[model samples]
Target: MMMTGSALTDEAAEAETLVHSTKTDKPRRIAILSYRSTPHVGGQGIYLDYLSRALVERGHDVDIISGPPYPEVDERVKVIEIPSLDLYAQPHNGHFALRPRHFKRGEDLYEYFAHLTGKFAEPLTFGERLKRYFAEQKPQYDVIIDNQTLTPGLLSDALQKTPIIGIIHHPITQDRQLALDAEKSFRKRLLIRRWYGFIAPQIKVACQMPIHITSSGAIKKDIMREFGLKSEQLRVIPLGVAQEDFHPRDDVKREPLQIITTASADVPLKGLIYLLRAVAKLRDDLPDLKLKVIGKLREGATSKELEALSISDMVSFESGLTREELARAFCAASIAVTPSLYEGFGLPCAEAMSCGTPVLTTDGGALPEVVGDAGLVVPKADPEALATALRTFFKQSDELKAELGRRAFERAQLTFNWSRIAPVYETVIEEAIAR
Candidate 1:
C-alpha cells in the first residue's frame, strides 16, 4: 500500500513482460506470398492485407513477399519486394517492348515473351524469383502461405525448408469456362485459351501441395474436384471484413435512388453485363435510378451492352477508391449489388453488409453462403431474375429497406469480422507447424 512510484512502475513493467513472453512462446513466423498484390486491383490483394494484419495482431510475425503492384500492408507486417518486369504497368505498347538487359535473366525473358504472346506469366516468374530469394537469403518461416499463386517453382528444393500451404480461391477452371463461353469466334477462343495456359501449371502445383486452404466450402469443393485433392487435405476458413472501418456512418445520408455494385467491367465472370441489362430493364419505371460501378470502364462486352441498352447516361464508373472512400460509397447507397457468375468468396457482399447496406446478389459460387438470408439472391447469369428482384426492392417501403440493412450489418458483424476469423487462421498455422 505504501509502495513508491518507482516500485509501482517496475511492477507494471514486469507484468507486461510476463504477458508478452506468454504470447511469444508459441508465436509463429509466417510468410505470405502473392504474385500481384495491389489492394485495389482485386480480392487477392485485400485478402493478403487483412489476413497478414490480423495474424500480426494475434502475436505472429508476418512477412509479405510480393511482385509489382505491391500491397499496402500494415507497418508491423514486413513486405519483401520481389522485382519482375511488371509489364502491366507499362503505358500503351510498352508492355510488348523489351530492353537488351531483359535477355540476361531467363525469368525476365520468359515474362516478356509471355506477355508479347498474350499470356499471363506473373505467377511463374514470381515463383522463380521467390525460389532464388529463398536460396540466397534462406529466410526462416514456420509456414509459407501461398495466396493462390500455385507456381511450380514453389516446390523447388530451395523452398523445402518450411511447410507450404496453398490457397486456391476457387479454381481458375471456372474463369476459363466463363471466358470461353463469352466468346464465339474461333480466333478469340484460341486466344482466350492461350491467355489461361497458366492454369495447367497451377493444377500441377496444387496437386503437389500437401495442404490447401480455401475461403469457403464451395471453393473447397471446386479445388477438390479440379485438382483431385482429398477432403482432409483442404481447410476452409472464411474471409473477414474490416467491420470498424466499413460500418455505417450516421452522418452520411443514404441516396434513396442510388445503387452501387463492385464488379470488374470486362471480366465475364463478374456478370457486369447481366447487371447492366437489369438496370436497362428498370430504366422505364425508375427514371431517377442511378447505378455506380466501382471498376474500370473499358471497351468490351460491357461497353457494347451499355450502348445497346442506351442507358450509359444512367451509370457511372469509379475505380481505385481508397478503403475509406469505398466504405462511404457503400454507406451512401440505397442498395449494394453483387451480380457475379461465380465467386470463391463474395467479398463485396460482405463489405457492403458491414457498411449496413442492403445487398442483392446472385446465387453464384459462395454468394449464398456469404449473404445468407440477409440479402436477396437471384439465379446466376440471369438478367431478368435480377431485374425482378430489384423491382421488388424498389416497390418496398423505406421501413423494409432499413430493416434489411440492420440485419445485413448484424450478420456481417457476427460472421465476417477479423476478430472472429483470425483465430481460425492461427489454428491452421499451428497445425501446419505441428506437422
Candidate 2:
C-alpha cells in the first residue's frame, strides 16, 4: 500500500515541528563527579549509577566524570574517564594481582604508599583532576552534581568560580564516631580516626557550598550537627528504588523462614551484631531461620558477636550481584532487615518493600523515618526487640505476612520510586543553576 503525497507531507511537517519545539528548551547538561565507581564497593557508586541514568532517561545530557572502575551507566550517557591514584583496591574478583596501574610517577607512588599506611588519597587526587577537567573541556554544564566526593579539589582555587552542588550521602563524621565507639585499642582508634580525616574537607565543602543535598532528614540533621550548617543550608531528598524491577516472586520457594540484609557485615554503623544476636536468641524457636547477607562481612565486633552467640552456622554471605539479582533475592526471602545503628536513609528497607517483602528495621537514623508505619520497627542496639519482631513475623500466617507485604509494596510505590525522585532532583539542579 502506498501512502498519499499529502500524508507524507503531513509527516514531514510534524517532524519539523517536533524538532523546532525541542530546540527551544536546551537539554539540561549535567556533570557528575565521583572518585570511584567500583561495582562491588560503596553506596557512592550506586548513587552515581542510578541518579545519572535517571537524568539521562528524562532527556538530559549527562556526563559522569569519574575515576577508576567506571560506573555502569547507560551507553548513551557520556562517561569521561578521569584517572587518579586508585589506592584501597577492593580485591577485584578472580584477579588479585598486586601490579600497579597508574603509579608510574613519584607522586603517584607516594600516594599509593600513603594509602597503604591507612591514609585515604583518592578524594584528594580526584579533586585535583576535577580542576583539569574544567580547564580542558570548559564545558559549562547547567550544574555539577558531585557524588559526595566532598574534595576541596572540586572547590579548588582555580575552579571556585564554577557552580558545584555537593551531595553528601551521610556525614562521614558519623562513620568516624561509630568507628571510635567500636574500636578496641587506642592505636586502632587513632588509626581509624586518621583514616576518616579525609572527611574533614568534605564537611567543610558541604558547609561552604551554596547548595547541598542529602539522602534523608536524619542525615540532614547529622550533617548539620557534625558540620554545623544551618537548616536552610541542607536539602533532604530521600533515595528511591525502581518499583517495576523490585516486585516479589510468588513462585520462588521460601527457605523454611529466611531473612535478608544488604551490606550487613563490616560497618559498625550497620549494627549487624544486634541482628546476629537476635537470630541466635530465636534459633531455638525458629530452628530453620536463615540469614542471607548481601555484603562482605567485615571481621569486627559484629562478627565476634555472631561467634559469641553461635549463630554463624545459619548465616550465608553473597556479594557483587547486579541490581536484578538483588531484586530476585529480595523476592526469594521472607523478610528484609536493616539493623544499621544509623542510616542516611534506609534504601534497602524501601527496596525490599518495593519487592513486596516486609522489612524489620532499627529506629536508628533514617530507617524509621523512611519505613514509616508500614514495616516493623524496633529500637537500635537491642537484640530483644529485634528478636520479638522476628518472632512475630515467623509465627504469623502467610496470609498476614502477605497482607503486610502488600501494604509495604503500596508505600514504596507511592513514595520512593525513582520516577518520583528524579523530578525533585531536577528542581534542585535548576535552583542551583539559577543562582
Whose lDDT is greatest here?
A: 1
Most TM-score-accurate candidate: 1
lDDT of each: 0.85, 0.75
Clashing pairs in 1: none
Count of clashes in candidate 1? 0
What count of clashes does model 2 give?
2
* TM-score of every model versus the real structure: 0.93, 0.88
Per-residue lDDT tens digits for candidate 1, residues 92-119, read: 6456568898888899999988988889
* Candidate 1 TM-score, C-alpha based: 0.93
Weakest 10 consecutive residues, lDDT, candidate 2? 1-10
Q: Write the per-residue lDDT of candidate 2 for residues 1-435, one digit (tens) a residue.
A: 111011112221222232222221446888888888865676667777778878887789999989997888778778889866454444642123234654555445645666766767678778777777778767777778888888887766556665788887777777888889978899988889777768877777777888888766666767788888887776666677766677777676655499999873487898887888889899889898999989876666667777788888899888877788898898888999888898887777888989888788887777766776678888888888889888988888999888878878887886676776777777677778778
